[model samples]
Target: MAGTEGIDITRRNKKPRLLTDAERDQLDEFVDSIHYSSRYNDDHYEYRHVQLPKAMLKKIPKEYFDGGRGTLKLLWEDEWRGLGITQSLGWEHYEVHEPEPHILLFK
Candidate 1:
C-alpha cells in the first residue's frame, strides 16, 4: 500500500460501485497480511507469493475477480500505471491462482 496515496486501491473499479465498509475492512486485512519475497532463480530474481486464506475469496466482491481478468492495477509513484488486463502467462506471481475453491493465492 505504500505508493497508493492517490490511488483508490480499495474499490474494484472506477465506477460508482464503491466497496462496502465490511469489504473494505476485509481488503485492508488482506493487504496487511500480504508478503512479498524474491529468490534467485538462475541469473534473475523470481518473486513469490504466499497462498492466501480461502475466506478472502468470499469477503471480496465478486467483481474483483473479473473472471481472471485483473480488477486491480499496478501502482507506481502514487499513480495507477499501465499493465492493463492481460491473460496470465503462468509464471506471473501476481496472477490470482485458485487451484481449488479452498485455495487462493495472489501477490
Candidate 2:
C-alpha cells in the first residue's frame, strides 16, 4: 500500500481496486523527472564544498525541501545574516531592502 500507486475502492460486495502497471510506471517517471532537475539536486546533494551546519539545514521549509536551488539565491539581505551564514564562501555582500514593510504590532 505504501509504494503502490493506485486507487482502492471497496464496494459492498467486491474487492478493492488498484491502478494498472501502466499507471504506476507513469507516476514513477514523473517522480524521476522531478529529481533529475536542479532543484532536487540542490536539496539532496551533499554540499560538500560548503559543509552547512545541521541547524541551518533544519530551518529550511517544506516548500524548499525539493525545489529551491535558485530560490535560495534570492534571499533577503537581513535573512542571510540572521541565518548566521553567507552564500558561497567567497561572495561579496550586497545590501537589499524589502519592497514594503508593514508593522503588525506596536508593542
Candidate 3:
C-alpha cells in the first residue's frame, strides 16, 4: 500500500499482486475478524507467519504461502500482510495531496 516493490520494502515471496476494491473490502472484514499474531506466531523457516484464517487462505493463490517451510518462510498472503511488512520496515508514507487553504465552517 505504501511502497512500490523494492523501493522501501522488500518484495514478497510471490510476485506482487494488486487488490481490487471488492477484494480490499473483503480483506478488511476478514482482518477485523482475525486475531493474527505476526512476530510471535508459529515458525516458518527462519521467519514467522501472521497466522491467517484457513478458509480465507484457501482462496488465495498457493504461491502466496511458502509451502510449509520450517524457517525463513514468507507468510504474506493479502493486503494486510503487505501493509504490515511495509510499516515494519519503516517505509515512509508518500504525500497523497498538498494541503489546501483551510476553510472556516463556523464562527
Each model's C-alpha lDDT? 0.37, 0.26, 0.34
TM-score of 3: 0.37
Summarize candidate 3's per-residue lDDT along 1-107 as a digit string, tens digits.
22243321332445456556665555554454443333322232212223344455544544443344312222233434542222244222211111211110000
Ranking by lDDT: 1, 3, 2
Candidate 2: tens digits of C-alpha lDDT, residues 80-100? 333333334322222111221
Model 3 clash pairs are: 44-71, 45-70, 45-71, 45-72, 46-71, 46-72, 47-72
Steric clash pairs (candidate 1): none
How well does candidate 2 score on lDDT at residue 95?
15
What is the C-alpha local distance difference test score of candidate 1?
0.37
Q: TM-score for model 1?
A: 0.39
Q: Lowest summed lDDT over 10 consecutive residues: which window, candidate 3?
A: 98-107
Could you say which candidate leads in lDDT? 1
Clash totals for all candidate models = 0, 0, 7
- Show the lowest summed lDDT stretch of 10 residues, model 1: 77-86
Q: After superposition, how far is residue 43 of candidate 3 from its true place, in Å?
A: 15
- Candidate 1 ranges beyond 4 A from true positions: 1-21, 28-45, 68-93, 98-107
